[model samples]
Target chain A: MAALGFAALFNVPARCLPIIFLFGAVGIFVKLLLLLFGINIVFACLAGAAAIGFLSIPAAHYKHAPPLIFYIPAVIPMVPGIMAYRMMLGLIKLTESTQTLNYNTVLFETVNNGLKVLFILISLSVGVIVPMLLMRKESIKHVRVPFSKK
Target chain B: MDQAIKSVRREEMKQLGKVLLKAGTMLMSAGANTGRIRNTINRIASAFDYSVELHISQRALSLTIMDEEESSFVSKLRRTPPHVINFTILSGISKMSWNIVQDNWSSEQILADLERLEKMPHYHRWMVLSLVGLAGAGFCALANGSPMDLLFTFLASFLGLFVRQEAVKANFNPYLAIYFAALTASLIAGGAVKLGLGHADSYAFVTSVLFLIPGVPLINSFSDIIDGNIQNGITRGVNALVISFSIALGIFTSTFIYQFQ
Candidate 1:
């Protein structure tokens, strides 16, 4: 959850910071609750992304900034570093002939890991964007957030 | 007076269209989501009392503005190259876009605004270096690191981020920057572990280097694809994948060479 500090690190205006924090926290909380139910990881991520997206819509309305300003940073903490690492490790094993692990086993694991990472990426994007799609087209009426250049 | 008025209006449209495109180009280059890019540009044009017909592709942006006579349209196109995040400039542009929506800034005023937005000082260099490096320690903690692991993570992250910034500023390929940064971080983490630094496994190394991952592109690519911008989405997705592959390659090289367990 500390990784969600990216909104601040990315220099998001302080007025909009607290709400982005809440949206990110809610997203993570939802994902954890789903996981405790033994929900599949991809679905959990999609749900998390959805919660982030849903919450950020109101935040965006309140902050008068782009929905993405809140949603993208809110979802950053869930990008799944372990799956990416595993995928890379599996590929490494498959490429080298000297590995103690069998080549077929390595290949299978590599493919599985790659697919999982791809699905997670897909889920995160689709999850957030679905909200935008379902909502009314964004108009200029709400673009009122003041930003500091500092 | 009517003749003079027509000529002046023509001049205003020409300048407004040019600067509006300029703002859109920079925003695209900075990697704002595709949807926001279109909305912001549209708002700028509407502010100037011109409607634009825009065509956005993977590498370039093109838009057309109708001539005052309605018989022809003037078009402008620009190629956009992705750059490092400068939230100050981005946030400044956002404010400018809002101001355009709220005020009837003259064409020259809009042009000046664009220039000032472009010139806003970037965030402090050392602050970025330290905080981003601190993000490395944050990753280690997320990985359940011991205190020793946190120290090593901080050192590796800060050092690697410096090199990565240098490579990017030198206009090295994005893949090369990711690979170099990941390799540096992993080597530092692995070396510290090898020296009996009290870390038990190589997972800390992976976590330390995870900051090199391209979170923005990955998410933006998906956003593009979902927006039905197939060409832009695929290009962004490929770019993100290549960068991730480079990062993985760097980590694999470290593991292979150092034989980190």
Candidate 2:
């Protein structure tokens, strides 16, 4: 999964293997840090996003390719796909209970999953967007080729 | 006078070569992993005084150059008249393509090699698409859904391939492409759920959308800002957000319509 994400991110016509591997290793470290600090998934995601953003600077400076390849894979583990599925299931079960099933437990589970997906999406977006906006003024200059003297 | 004319033409050719190189680099970089080529060409072009006509083809980078015409007849005889120099740069990025050590090659040689590589046949586009599909499938499976949900997810993934291919061909706004894709995927999922495919349909929908996430750009933008690349960071951030929002809007629209119905 990480490899696919890396390939998708790099999606360019050059050698980004080194960059991908380096970012992947750093991502594991960030996950470790999150575990050690006992941070919730939302905060952990934010921390991971920040770490990836910080680590990508050198690669961007040295390489003209965008730093996205490194950063995207680092956050793949926390994207809330499962939670989203659960939310859908919950909604369906809730609807079923109200119709003919009369199952309160299904209703409760559905609500819980729906709320979880919402919270996760909100937090993930906040974690990603806040740091990005805060550091907006720091992007590297694209390498401009010198124009020849006529 | 003849000797002077020859010297001027020689200088013009050198400048023309530089322009073609620069144009080629730009086109190649627009595709993928050719940053070094782009930089090298930019450097060489900066040293010349020529206009460049860059064409980005689906398979290769084509460039045409026109030298600035001399004002005086004497100067015209002494230098080459402004004219087009056409050349193509191949995109040499494939699983089979390996990078030679930069230390062993001069910058000019590297540029030449990249230009050569651009002409080599590689499966970069297909490889990227295949990987994306595989990952989307893997994510869907991991979500622990029923087989029906998995099939729906796979269909969504297949749809994504068409979206990406169209986006690349159109050079349309990546954000717009992402949003449309998201909406389409969500709609399909919602319909499936509504039709009694089980709650797994929604999971399939969300998991499939995962394949379209601009995860890399979001990360890259943040990294660029932290590293003091304010302009690059901001541009990338905006671009990434546009795509993300597009995906979100797609979901919102689909959900809204589904609910309304």
Candidate 3:
């Protein structure tokens, strides 16, 4: 539902919504499954996004649309929105109070959440784009060139 | 006669240049990454036996289209419209570029198709509001908010997005609209928490404004940098950071207002 809503918000073509839903569902499932095994959250997100990225080529071929349309909204649901919010709130709190005790805790929360948001975002974007780039290279190499040597 | 041929070649170059610029602007404004935009334009130009050199920045595109013989080319620049996330237009033009290559479309035909695409309908306002609101609630639920939290989140984001739409329509700066939307959402959620309405008011408060996250810009910025479009990538990254700051300020204001209560 989150993916579908974002797809709509992005004005994705109506025909591609189902693929978005599929990618979203599968991506989250993979992440959750990895989390159940005690995997780190950042690595789990990476794995999930890689799953969606690998699936995007086939999905794009099937729909004849750009692979990006399928994965962008799907990957969004995995973004650490709450972490970003908490980080922002923590930063704000730090500014309001300068006492050493409160300052240390607020600073810790701010840094912790900030670092997690940064790494998770990096993992998500890298995980999704790297596979597409790899697969895309293979497809490009297969294109028939006129008068090419056998 | 030679002069006549030169003039004709110039006219042809000019026409083709216009077409390339139009296509580039559409893709850029639709939030496509720089590589895709460049690749698509190159593909379309190659179909017409021309090679293109393109420079894409955050606000404008500069294009030079040269014939196979490297004679009688045109160079043109066009400013892109404000960035909007419209994947339909992006996908439409991409598919059309492929079709152009396969079917050998004329410039006139391509222009006609572009005209058709420019008129594509967006989702109705009501649909976007409700769906985005639900997306916010979904985010809240994912954070383990209770049912009451979800309900308030839905209401908060619904009104927040509505305010954003109206603000955009009223010609406010886009960042200001985002700030207003985030403020509205956080205030609503904070109010619910203050009133003792939900078990997980903090979750609702934090997640109700997640709809405003600049996911596309942030992701595209990273993609652009990876693809070596460093200038474009940095500009987009800064844009995303500014938007994040706006959202944070909005949330901060509401939190500050309610924390003493």
Leading candidate by TM-score:
3
Question: Between the candidate structures 1 and 2, which one is better when assessed by lDDT?
Answer: 1
| TM (B chain), model 3 | 0.97
lDDT of 1 by residue, A21-139 (tens): 67767877888899999999899999999988887778766766667778777787777787778877777666665656577787888788889888887798888878877774553
Q: Candidate 3, chain A: TM-score?
A: 0.91
| Superposition error at B213 for model 3 (Å) | 0.4
Per-model TM against the reference: 0.88, 0.53, 0.96
The CAPRI category of model 3 is: medium
User: Candidates' lDDT values, in order?
Assistant: 0.74, 0.53, 0.88
For candidate 1, write residues B50-162 as lDDT tens digits.
77878886578898887546754578888876755545556667777877667767767877877887776545667656766666776677567888888888888877877
Judging by lDDT, tell me the better candidate of 2 and 3.
3
Residue A29 displacement in candidate 2 (angstroms): 10
Q: Please report how far candidate 1 places residue A57 from its true position, in Å.
A: 1.8
Task: Evaluate residue B253 in candidate 1 and report its C-alpha lDDT on the 0 to 100 scale.
Answer: 87
RMSD of each: 4.1, 10.6, 2.2
Worst 10 residues of 3 chain A by lDDT: A141-150
Candidate 1 TM-score, true structure as reference: 0.88
Give the C-alpha miss distance for residue A37 in model 1, angstroms: 2.2
Stretches off by above 4 angstroms in model 3 are: A141-150, B1-6
| Candidate 3 lDDT score at position A33 | 98
**Candidates' DockQ values?**
0.32, 0.18, 0.60
